[model samples]
Target chain A: MASSKDVIHSKLWQEESEPGDPFTATACYCSGYDVYGELLHKASYVDYLYLLFRRERPLPHVARALEILTIALGNPGPRDPSVHAAMSAGVGGSPAAAALMAALAAGAGSSGGAREVLLAMEVWTRCGCDLNAWQTAIASPPVATRQLVWPDIDHFPGFSPYARDVSIPVRQTLEALADCLPDGCARWLLDHRQAIENLVGLSLAMPGVAAAALIDMGITPEAGEMLTLLLRLPGAAAHALEQGEMGFRRFPFFSLDISNDPGPAMPKEGTAR
Target chain B: MNERPPLETFEGSLNTTMGGCFPGERAVFRGHDLHAELSDSDWIDLYVFGITGRRHTPSQLKVLHAIWVNTSYPDPRLWNNRVAALAGSARSTGILGISAALATSEAAIYGRQIDIAIADFLVRARRAIESGRPLSEVVGEELRTRRSIGGYGRPVAKSAADERNAVVLAIAKKEDLVGGGYLKLAFEIEEFLLSGRWRMRMNYAAIAAALALDIGFSPREYYLYLLPAFLAGMPPCFIEASTRPEQATFPLRCSSLIYEGPARRAW
Candidate 1:
């Protein structure tokens, strides 16, 4: 019953840690140990989760506490010197170690594993970790494909998925990695015409790499439709929309002209309701 | 253990059951018809509290489709024939019909009503989004036409009152809720409304299973709350409306790690 803010402030989320450790606190705001378990579970939780990128035994809960700190410091992916240094500090890699490695990798920049972090964030939303960090981490200049230890941004054009400073990297990561996403990544580059049209017309505007990546993929026929609409609108209106000040009034007229009946798209047929 | 005798076996079926206004007249299935009427999505928003309007299995979806196709009625008994067949099927198939009937027939009935009454009002809003229409035009049109159904009507956490209820609305209010997180919200809401919560409703044992899709509860971990919730609360209102005490009191028990406790609702 506590407000999200109150719940966030509760002791349930507190984790004492060493000064230089990476942050591993559960972002969903579940019990502390459980969050560690989710990151290191032997089953699909570990295998599929972006956090456990490498194979290892679970880290001591104490060391894992660094995850919260590290993430707070800025999403440390595999490339992050600090995260790699933390991984090296562990004696024998445990599941927690593996999760730290993966979490680090996800932040390492536009890697598929990074996308997996987005998925983990979505699944573990209750944790209430800071999301903005994840966006910044994922948006960090990506590493290219050939050198790819995992799927990094350098490999995927315009593929930044998380918005910097949104919430917690864990939350954003999970949402990005949700089930039934395109190309197995939470945010995919639209590489298709219809999709691009949707974006241009502003029918399809997602956040982060998903939006930019989609545009990078290619301008599709859908993009053309959206472009057509944008062009037809008064120049001021188009600028307003681009400036994030667009409203929702003329949608029906444009839709009606484009499709005659905004039937399926409108939800209710015959009229706009 | 609240198992009760079936309504048909009850000495006075009509005496035990209360008839509310039929679909098309009032909101019967809690907020199903109302929610569907408001949006153009393919899915129905079902609010199943206890055993009365529980989740439907795959086969039950078919039965629900059957009942929905069967009739539009003021008499609740109109569902009896369908329910009897469903109960008989459940004996073998292990999935009941009542849930399906309620989900489909009731959704269709109410969706039509709300859509009919509010279609014009929605058009201008849609146009505004599509055509890059001025905010003034959209608001003015909605106001001039007296078409705004202002209250989001969904109960949210009291603390988060300033937060918009729906992702679409949040998108419209992009400045207040900027960035990828906004898209993430939309995706989460869409998933909850379409699949995850929908499946949870079908399983019927989770605490979240008893609540509406729009109502937020941690999905998997919420099982810890089921037993206590059932023990503390009344059965779903619709079940109380149609079935007898004996039949209505189906004991809520499961071998899974069930947590018997109070369900936290935003309302």
Candidate 2:
């Protein structure tokens, strides 16, 4: 049992009591911008993010790759759990913050979100960056029959309903991004696209490409999910706001049977436990 | 093979005071063999023991369970429950819907954070009173720093009589757990706060915090322990809503929205 004093002082990061204002700094400004005091005016948001995470400016190709990945996964449509949760919250007349919170929670799951990408990244690492080894392992006897044996690990993060037939522009953008980057995970993914598709029986999803790009850029698996969350936030906000504005409470197309008993019965007043 | 990180550089140890499970063999809970030694134990008892690394008497467990049961409202109007219902209405998967609801349930105003704050306050206040500071002065100092105490106020309603609070208090009294210093001080603070025009009453968060603090659970432990309390009733809401016509739970119309923005313009 830690005493109150011990608990309070044991925090890992304690801000200095007399630290100067955060907005205006003498040395390095926001996200390591110290050159000529003019980094903010010139750098793009992705460049700033790159500096913030990696503590250095991104290569042009790296910046472009991040931009492409971010745009590719910007909107997963209303069917995605996060977007649907946001719209549902909006339809219920919840405030914007509440809707956003619901969306974030939905997006934090192991399926159809960043957690899936994290799992895929873990599998990639576990396979020692060898696609052949991964394919062999998944294709072997006992594991092959299970299909989804590993806990919390999605064997294919990029397999989506639309994977079989990706839009031409999206494919072209991915191909273009692949051409600009070094021969790392992203390039490997592009190079072995058909093989991966044949093995998984689905085309690569944008999230899989994003995960490879993130790993190539030196982002860890844990941080990858957070980056994915940040990327999806704007799209979530948009869906929530749109639902709050233009949508009705009842989604027009969906249909199901309403339950008579919605929840557990509350203990009657004055009843003994 | 990938090179493993140096073991000497690790910040922590391999041993955990918490429980662990072996795939098909056994589970060790709080240093005890769960299967052999504690198989007959109550689920809530095992849960508390696993979390706090301390065992509670049956009376204490009863009171704790009662606190959770009392706060588990089945009504979907609550914030977390609303999230669950909305998830169902949107036809999302069970895990996504429930996780979303649980995540939103950690809100500052009406959720686990408030309970954590309350527990932290009670622990500090108890220590202050033990150190010779008067209860009123300590409470007044706290109020001076923050406008309203976390556990004391009921924002939506004005009544002091809450059914859940009454049930929790009754259980505490029956279990002989009501005489603790923190509980006493909580009552004193409630009296002091209600002395003037302020209509704030001691709600479930305050009572639960005081009880938990008295039972030797720290503020952080109290927060983690109480995670499943409100969670128990949330799933049924999601389950029920999923069975209903999609987007039917608390359905609204576009006309219901009050737009205060500029006149519609082309993009």
- TM-score for chain A in each prediction: 0.18, 0.73
True contacts kept of 1: 0.00
lDDT of 2 by residue, B16-91 (tens): 5555665466666665666777789898888887778788898889888988898887678788888888888888
lDDT string for model 1 (B23-122, tens) is: 3433223223433343333222132121233343333233222222222232333332244333333331112233333323212122222222222223
Question: Model 2 chain B — which ten-residue stretch has the worst lDDT?
Answer: B258-267
Q: CA lDDT, every prediction?
A: 0.28, 0.69
Task: Note the DockQ of each predicted structure.
Answer: 0.02, 0.02
Error of 1 at B138 (Å): 17
Question: Per-prediction interface RMSD?
Answer: 26.8, 24.3
Fraction of the true interface contacts (Cα pairs closer than 8 Å across chains) found in each model: 0.00, 0.00
Q: Model 1 — interface RMS deviation?
A: 26.8
Report, for all candidates in order, the number of backbone clashes.
Answer: 94, 4
Rate residue A135 of model 2 by lDDT.
89
Candidate 2 docking band? incorrect
